[model samples]
Target: MTEHAPTTYLLAGGGTAGHVNPLLAVADALRAREPEASVLVLGTKEGLEARLVPERGYELLIVDKVPFPRRPNAAAARFPLVWRRAVAQVRRHIRDRDVDVVVGFGGYASAPAYVAARREGIPYVVHEANARPGLANVLGARRAARVGVTFAGTPLRGGEVVGMPLRREIVELDRAALRDEAATTFGLDASRPVLLVFGGSLGARRLNDTLAESWPAIVGAGWQILHAAGERNELVDSAHPDYRIVPYLDRMDLAFALADAVVARSGAATVSELTALGIPAVYVPYAVGNGEQALNAASAVAAGAARLIPDAEFTPDRVRGEVVPLLADPETLGALRAAAEASAPAARAGTAAVVAQIDEALGRSAR
Candidate 1:
């Protein structure tokens, strides 16, 4: 009954919804382009992909793996055995399923997919969303036939700076409807400009505490807040009349779409989505790691998209100084919004070529 050619494509990304959801969006787009193409998700059993991928009506090939431990000694000791087992699982999937293309979307699941794709002599590509590429994606890009980047500054070799792939569902939301919806769904006051605050799932405690301490001033600015305080911050006065605090933003697309101006930590995915939507934000990148968050925010700033306020200066006084000015000046906020682009990640033209490459490689490897 289907008019499209039948093909199998392997979609890989996981650990967090940030990575996994984008992969799902890309795969969904592929289906829209060719309804007959079948998608199999290659993901770690331990990650959210296990729940999310299956929920989207795709078959999930689970692999047992863990990320390369950031901390050493005791954690590092388990790496060798885990690596061996992961490679074995990936090899088995390719051999058994006749997989077509292995696309790496960053994170641990891509590790095994990278190994399996190389071993099978298949065509695999890496889609790096961060300004500074992550470990798994860094290695994966070396052998990838093509590399796709969401940000302009990613160090992916042989990569084209394709904007981050977001879902059509997200892209289609009516902005006014979203803001009005978020006001009710999150129990926020429409009279005040809503400064939607969030830091992904499991939440950010430090951000939560700082927001709680600064809530009075934030309210005094004629602004209401929908803060996603981490679940651990149970003691904070989230139920106050002016504040709408939640454990998570179940509808992030709507939240970001509706927010007037947002305050949050800058993650690569956040930067991509905000840029894609043209949302203005004040970012407090985590004061840790290789300072990638700061680097990521810096790129957005270069584009006039956002402002990075150092975490050290996150006190009420400093927060009010940066925020009140930006909030009061619609001109500045408008500039930030103008930075969001509808075409930063445009690849619809080369999409069929990518899909064909995926199909040929996956089919050959499956053979």
Candidate 2:
């Protein structure tokens, strides 16, 4: 009997958690399914993947950080040489590792990986995590073997809604069963409804300021607060019995379990996780970006699974007027929860669907 060779995969992406997290999730799933297979990561030395991929027990291949120049500047003049070098670097890695397939999550490294894979006649897949596709993914999707997206209606060629590949802790979490433990972990009353608030790792100053002004009213309305005030944030924890503020939340699964409702940014991962877990939320789209955050939360708002509060409008008055009222109205909150639950089927199948896509691409390459 002949033994088949182990499949080798080159998973590429990384910069922010938005790109790195999904890439790691898919890598973990691939490794779990086929322990003998080689799962490698391609990233820049400066990216989050440099640290995270190694920590996750995957080999990290270095790539040049070649940013696509937007305007006609000095960098634009040098782009051709830099871009070619990046592509050649990826090609060398592909040749050395004998990579069977390249899966990209869209970052500095992925654009070159896509080019290298195409040049080497290897199949490659693209996963876009936002409703507004990134420039790299947009370019890759044109000739990719398969294109997957976290949200529906993303304007990428051949893109399919594959949801967001989430962390295992989130995917396996049993919120109801873990509520009491989560409440104790945060020193909160599990019997009372808790409003969980966060704004990524650096913390959103807008969210921190607004909450500081309105926590008194929120706690007074019979709801407790469990707020992750970002690592760099200066928001001090108040001595109020119902308010608990922490610098960061290492165990977001527990925080999710204790949360009756959430007030946070509408990042792609955040939106996907909330919808998948059937957690009703009021989203404040970070106003700094190209309006993608607002676009990320649109479908949920349209489905009555969540509410949107623009950054400029997410003031203390708005929280008191809308958020506090919603908390007091259990009927509306229940409806939002039910809507989120109803919308969860597609959101929860992301990891499996992405793996299926990779398998299909491999099969096609073999044929």
Candidate 3:
């Protein structure tokens, strides 16, 4: 009997947390499943991966970021040469490292990784974190061995809804058990209903401004708030006893434990985490991109797990008129919670699904 050699993986993606986080989740999964496997991360030096990948104990491979030109200009004319350099860099790494699979999560790093993998006759996989796929993933999906998407409606050639691969902390979090500790950690009473407000890392100006204006009313209505005002937030603390405002939160699981409801931007990770945990949310999709944020939250909303407020209409008046009333109604909140629980997929297997696809491809290649 002969033992098979361990698989070698080259995971590519990184720029924002959306890409880096999912990449890390898959990396972590791969490592856990096959402890002896060699897992490498390919990313640009300037990306968050440079810091995060090494911290997470994976080898970080550097590649130059080549952004595709949308408009015809000098940069557009120079794109082909720059893009070629990136592909060549990736191809060299693939050859030298003897990578068995190239998994991409879509970033400036992924396009070249995809092209390189194809040229090298290596199996490749793609994971798109948005309902609307990005340019890199769109190009890569055509030839990928497997393509997984965070949302059901993502328009990719071979896309399957795999949910989002969540952090281990979130996947294992028992919110009910941690409520008292979480409430204490955030300096709020566990007995009261908590409304969690956040707008990503840098914070949402509109969300912060509206919540700041409406906090007095929110607190007056007997709800506590745990608001992460972002690192560069301009919203001043109103000094309410029940309201806790911080620039950022390192422990999101704690916040989720105490939160009865959430007000946040509907980024892929945020929506996935909230629904996975069965936490009801009022989504304020960022007013940018191809409206992907809104699309990300669509299923949650349609399933009655969440509500959506257009960016332009997310004002103090709307908060007072709409959000306040919803917060005040326990029955409505209960309904939302139930819906959230129903809407949330069995997310524990998201990474496994991706890994399964890779394994399937490997088996086929071997045959």
**lDDT of each residue in 239-274, candidate 2, tens digit only:** 998999999999999999999999999999999999
Residue 73, candidate 2: alpha-carbon lDDT: 100
Candidate 1 Cα deviation (angstroms), residue 143? 1.2
lDDT of 3: 0.90
Worst 10 residues of 1 by lDDT: 342-351
Whole-model Cα lDDT per candidate?
0.74, 0.93, 0.90
Which model scores highest in TM-score?
2
User: What is the TM-score of candidate 3?
Assistant: 0.96
Model 2 worst lDDT run, 10 consecutive residues: 358-367
What is the alpha-carbon lDDT of model 1 when measured against the actual structure?
0.74
Per-residue lDDT over 249-351 for candidate 3, one digit per residue giving the tens place of the 0 to 100 score: 9999999999999999999999999998899999999998799999999989998999999999999889989899999998998999999988665655577
Residue 266 lDDT, candidate 1, scale 0-100: 88
